[model samples]
Target: MGVFTKFGVRLLLALVLLCSCSIGYESDIDYSLMPVKQGDKWGYINAKGEYIINPQFDGANVFTDNGLARVWVGDKCGFINKKCEYVIAPQYSSATDFFEGKAWTVKPKGAPVLIDTKGRSCFTLKNVRTVYNYSGGLAVVVDDNEMFRAINTAGETVFELSGPAFVTNFVDGLAAVQNMDRLFGYVDKNGKAVINSQFYGADFFLNGKAIVRADDMYGVVNKEGKYVINPQFAEMQQDYNKFLIKIGEQYGWCDERGKIIINPQFENAFPFFGANLAAIKMGEQWGYVNKEGKITVNPQFQFALPFIGKVAWVKSADKWGLIDEDGKFVVNPQFNDVLCSYRLFIPVRNYVVSEYFDVEGIISWINMMLDGNKVDGMTVTQTTISGFRKKYNLGEKGVSVEKKYSRDMSYEIYANGTFYENVSDGWWGTTTKQLPNARLDYVTIQLKLKDNENTRPLYDAVINALGGNNGKRGSGQYVKVKASPGIVTIYVSDKQIKDILNDNLGWSNY
Candidate 1:
């Protein structure tokens, strides 16, 4: 099973799992059905924004080349076909996207295993600390002994590195490895060091060359370890046949032989995208520049992204929108954020900056409760069960309120929302002592966790909004209650209610 830390939980969570392979593996992507958010629920939509699947799943991912997408049901994850039918039931505690007809999955309290699209276990991986996505017919794994090795789809160890060496996933038939000397080099799939560990830094091969750092400068090296471009630039990156090089404080473009194609002048720039136009920053705004260094698009937007096909996503006035190659607004700036997958722009509202969780709206609602203010036209401490029912008309809205009696003559009201939705579950309670006109003393909201990543930003944002990690307040303190492995709950009350909702749930200041 994977271990969890305060901030390091699910460190292996990745947004994109497929990589380029040279071993004739299928790598085509399906862009017909893209994941979109509709009022806390996730569903699939076409490029024209028509719902192909209704908003129901707790979470949704893009359909892979194999015509299957991963969807979440409550806490367990499963795979679904393009028709929104389950090909694999929601059972795995953790799972990865299918690549080349195979995926890696971990069941509850079980070791990791490789499964095919039909959900049949190909083989089990024992004592593996970490497993990366497969590339070039092999996947990299870190063993319990902290050693790196590569395993094929059949679960056989193809090669294992000796000594204290760190390696990366294969790309372009080569993987970068760092030797005991702390220097980087290239190694083939057969565990042979093709290039000596002599550079301060090295990157995976792209096209036929790679960017390497030596003598505190960047250059390009070919497969034969020969310098195609000598080390001289401060930094370098490859884009197609062009190279984006930075010198001192300016960015420009260079050719395969280190010839200056565009003079280094822009403050910041991205690699060339569609139509050979690159986004470059000037002053405090961003625009587009052609290969000839001509300003094609005027600098005006607060932020801009590379053109994917015919349009690109840009930010203005803190809102994201889509723009055509001519810099005209193709879509108005109304969404809180936008995500791009396979050249499709997906608009999302109330989005958090983290890739894993989207709970900005949930946090904002919780903050209102903590402030003892009105939330959704209802105040936490002053709202009674009867008043709440009257205000929202739960029956009319088709929302069922579950009632439970406690041993202390107190009753609790439990309500469940859409699975993995903004507010997954909610709780309200009152004791007989305050009966007839009883008011709520506490309110709790739970948010579902689909997967995990570097949650430091989300954690820090919540802490800052709730008066820091100490959970200080004027009338009451906020507590972060740990629920199941895939759930997080926030509690706001006039006084501590940890004992009332006791399931031995751990609590900590926000």
Candidate 2:
């Protein structure tokens, strides 16, 4: 989805705050140093409780390497240094950081244009609609005609390719692109068709090979676009070039040679190679494995994230915590929401910065889950998600919920505030619940809310209302729930969010 478009729909979506861990424990993060929201914006305050930058901007983008930032001033884009200097004037509509010394930006409603450290337009990027950050010697741009092309450091089209096609930039020497026949293939930097357009799908070349799909079967090919392994698996998906495929929905990873590095016993597996670790799922839990396919961290997390910086997130029951690479609890999965930290700075207009960072925490988990299912680097809601919450002491609760949805539905566990949907409502649901008392709160609920025609998105509907996404929910601009809270009070902005907690709970009215 286009970043701004998603941002638009989400602008009104509610934010949530989950109390995953106990309040205090020594953390590398000075709890006092985490950014704070001042009314409608996030501001930087040191442990001394002083605003490093005045609490003013609408949002703040995470700082980057140069001690500079991209902040939005009103609707214009600009850059600022840590000293709070507006180094790059806020004049454009949107902007990104400097890479190889040049940043890509766009005028309001305009295509992305390149600017050097001096902030001069490399050229008037006349027709392209969207762009990617400059990387690996090229930045992909989509023209007015919707063709994908690349530009080099000199602000010249080093290469160009036509579409209806993918904007996936070349990784290594190969990029994934669709052909005239609409089948996906790999292309070399010289625009040569290194891999034939024979696969129904293919990911960019990574390490040395790419996974190609024809019909529903999968296989591997080397950088030269040669079939290193013929298509055979019933299903295969690529992660940074390595393959994670299924044999009857069981997943494993394989090298370009089709050698299964991680065996096919996992219910779910990821090709995210970190340190020497990989993540795999079995039953309802997640664990870590080494390149040798040895189970390193036993499947224990309710849902796990690929390890980054030796810390991977794990969930046991209703809480998520962090485990180090050695499978020891580093930051135990106890915080209701966990946020990854970024520490560099960049130049941004004041308004953009205000709009960016203030709401980042709430979207972290939703984005993490979406990253796993993203088709290409592009994120969208195409796959259906459904699950059930086992009501305490209810013998047939699971069976009853399953019978309510499509038989193909795959589910994980259910806890308080779990969003369980049937076939009737999709992933962005109109059905959900809040089980503050863990699984003990047995509240059978249904919400059919329509706030602007279609039912307000169910995920955004309830979650937004609950204080799930940093609790930045707009007043009454969400799903009107009619629930029975059993434990913690329903809250919004920490005010015991009471849009539906009335009559029975009688906390407050909407």
Candidate 3:
């Protein structure tokens, strides 16, 4: 079995976090400077939505512990200080956020180098295919030989594992390692196994206990290699003071001693974050439950996120906004999408621009379709036709269905007759049998202009928003075509241009 299968779900979550450039020492994060997006540019904004750092960079990340933020200038990545000055120039192919006053950077066709906060190269690591950030004075690297090793900040190998083993960064003086047999155990700073590799999985130790798996079930284990709570639950995730457990596909809460605090009843649940309340899904709606399993917030939101500080991001209908602890809307639901980081800033995307031919409007629509994964509250390959109709309050007469060659299907929803949505499905013919519940493969909005109206301005706007015909902004390709006289159609889909051509939609390269 692969390492992912052996590590199970919790380790997969940790791996995903580790893979991101924003991964850092959480306690050292400075939330005062948060990254926000304005139009097509990124900048730092305060809690009050005031622009602290003007929108200039192509991309921006959260401020690390050392008062530096990673930003992208064109295709290069660098670090900038709070004063909007370049602390580290845009030179690296990619870079991770600073942790413990040091960061890892990769040069173009060069070895990965560890750099100090002042942009001085400490050392270059060779023969390593993968590198992790330094934690607890040690970092983990996977060598070209596919073996894990621990290295010091000086780039000297502290110790190499005895055999092929998967290792994690040092946490609390120990690191979780998996032996060749795919059994996990804890190893000390000197690479000595303190806990025997017997369990199917292991997590980083916290508060003297680590979650482990045995008999294909999860439980808690102490640092001394003894089970504190025997493996019994199907899954276990340690939150602040409670453990989110799964039993037979349902989620519940349990205390530290494995005492059930809440029955496994909800369809899904989120861990408590920055507050005592956690979001739980009941049927199709989401609500919050306190530590005692009391429903503090009723199930009303279309979607909900974990609480951060005094507020949480929630979805009401198709728009997202902020809500207080009592489930009251502190910020009205008006944004197409909202992103929060470090509980300090909110990046709002307003895709409903008034003029479709303007630069800002075109950019907003492009970002919404490509980056935001949305097209008028419907996500391709996720939102079913029935759900879309229900969400938009579209009746039978509002939507017109068309079967293409008895293999592909399309749903057209008209809005005031000037514009209409073309929802496509069954391109591969597999989804044709799943009508009504079949998810949309792609969506296109067609606009009918006035008699003899020029389409050049709208076409140019789309090209500019997409960073020219080369399509540099995102991976998705867009095609602008004049289907008929006085009718202009712009198709935006995650599918490639070649794949769209295969659909025989009569679209030509611009």
C-alpha lDDT (0 to 100) for residue 91 of candidate 2: 85
TM-score, candidate 1, is 0.59
State the lDDT of candidate 2 residue by residue for 1-510, as single tens digits.
111111101111001111111111111111222233456655554323355777556555544444555667687768766677888888877777665566777665344667777677786554445666665577777654467777777657887785466535555656778878878777677777777677677765545666676677777777666778888887665444356667766778776567777768888765553345777878877888887788888887766765544555566776645567788875443334333231110001111110111122323432342233221121122211122222323343342221111111111222223334334355565654432222212222222221212122333433553445233334321112332221122222212333344444322223
Model 3: per-residue lDDT, tens digit, 373-482? 44555554566666656766766433333221111111233221112334455484332232565555555556443422234554455555656543223444444333
Q: Candidate 1: lDDT over CA atoms?
A: 0.62
Q: What TM-score quantifies how close candidate 3 is to the native fold? A: 0.61
| lDDT (Cα, 0-100) at 174 in candidate 3 | 78
Task: Give a tens-digit lDDT track for model 1, residues 212-280.
Answer: 889779899999899999999987766567787889888898988999999988887766632457778
Q: Please list the residue runs of candidate 1 whose C-alpha ends up more than 4 Å from where it truly belongs after superposition.
A: 1-27, 54-58, 73-75, 163-166, 273-275, 341-510
Count of backbone clashes for each model?
Answer: 0, 63, 0
What lDDT score belongs to each candidate, Candidate 1 first? 0.62, 0.49, 0.63
Distance from true position, residue 204, model 2, in Å? 1.1
Task: Write down the TM-score of every candidate.
Answer: 0.59, 0.51, 0.61
Report the Cα RMSD per candidate: 20.2, 22.3, 19.9
Candidate 2's error at 427, in angstroms? 67
